[model samples]
Target: MSTPMWKRVIARILEALLAIVFLAPLVWVIICSFSPQAGSAQSDGWGINNYLTLFNYQAGLPTYLFNSIVVSLIAVVFSVVVCTLAGYSFSRFEYPGRNLGFMVTLSILMVPYASLLIPMMVWFKDIGLNDTLLGVGLVITLFQLPMSTFIMRNAFNAVPKDMEEAAMVDGCNSFQALVKILMPVVKPSMVTVGLLAFLEAWNNFMIPLYLSSSAKSTLPLAMVNMRQQTMGVIDYGATEAGVVILLIPCAILFLVLQKYYVKGFMAGAVKG
Candidate 1:
């Protein structure tokens, strides 16, 4: 089956094209960020001044970064806890409405975030949960829960039932079997779900816009205001620096859990 030179070449070409298409925006952002401000003779020149300003707190970046990190982390933790329990229940327990319940979870996944905005705000306001980090975190957790649950459910299903039976025979209770054995085996899936949830919360703008107070504006909202303020200026160095800051946590998270994510993806693909 090694007679596919033309096909291999074509595949490589297509991959390269896709990579360029995906990377063009990031490359442009980096270039624009390093470019000199208008009226400067040195156009397209690179400098670290943008990063310097970011660290210097001229743009309230520190507060934004802190707010984003706090909310994203909290959201991830809450989502993981809720989803792991629910997924385990759905996977192992034969209960009434199990299939119907999964269908409902799938239905939630189909609904776009935009459709829930107004109703979520109204509920948040009624409960006095508005304009707070906890409120934003809870909203992010709620939005991400169904997807994470679905992922974890499939992960749990992929585990061998024989192992659970053995654990039960060895005097292990249901909780002990899950925590001591199954949880360790499915660590990769948990990591994948957690990282994805964190990214979603970190990049969230609409929720933070409506739910976060001015003093607790997340990085995305801060970036929006920065863009508006610098509209006439040719220099986008600071803006790019902000984006770099916004991307750091996500980049680090993905790099650390890339192996797990790949494994989870493959496992889910197989199940599907």
Candidate 2:
């Protein structure tokens, strides 16, 4: 290993090259988002005019952003809560049809996602949940459940049963032990589930397309609508601006939670 200076240097060079290749498109988008374009509202000069145009489009950036945030938060909370309980049950308890039930939940993943949305749209409409942000969030949560449950169940299984038994011996009820002890131990998995749920709900287009209205559109849907111009011309400047806006939060979230997210997956993989 000490004699491998040349190999290390070559590896560094390759990594730099790969980074550049990956970053080039993102850099281009950021630059293009600020550059003035023909027929753009801010064609006067290079600036944030494209961003201003995006801000003013449709019901405005704030409305779409709020819609996206609300839906994503709902999905994150619902996914974490439901998956945590389901995973714990599947891993710790023996109930009739338990294996069959878990199998059914996982089987949902085998179905086509797009096909599921159409029939769900009809059901949601019948329940008066159609055309609402809550409906879209529920759909996102449903899709996240299978994978989230699997991750959580494995995470719970990775922990020693003796810890739970010890807590019970100390007079803590099962629910109390889970809440005060096991939940903290599994925090990383919960974070992983929440983050995945948030990202899916934030960027999901199909669910919103079928379940939400124009007024309740999320940022991705808003971006698609904003890209169209009169006479079929695409507004590249504002579109790039929208792309940058959409990318920023996701990038920041992943960077911030990278440590926990990796740990969560590793914890789950340990037992299964």
Clashes of each: 0, 0
| Structural similarity to truth (TM-score) of each candidate | 0.88, 0.95
Runs with alpha carbons beyond 4 Å of true place in candidate 1: 39-45, 52-59, 230-235
CA lDDT of every candidate = 0.80, 0.91
Q: Write the per-residue lDDT of candidate 1 for residues 16-63, one digit (tens) a residue.
A: 999999989877777766677653222446677776665554346678
Per-residue C-alpha lDDT of model 2 across residues 185-232, encoded as one tens digit per residue: 999999999999999998888889888888999999999988889888
Please state the error at residue 100 of candidate 2 in Å. Answer: 1.3
- Model 1 residue 100 CA deviation in Å: 2.1
Best by lDDT: 2
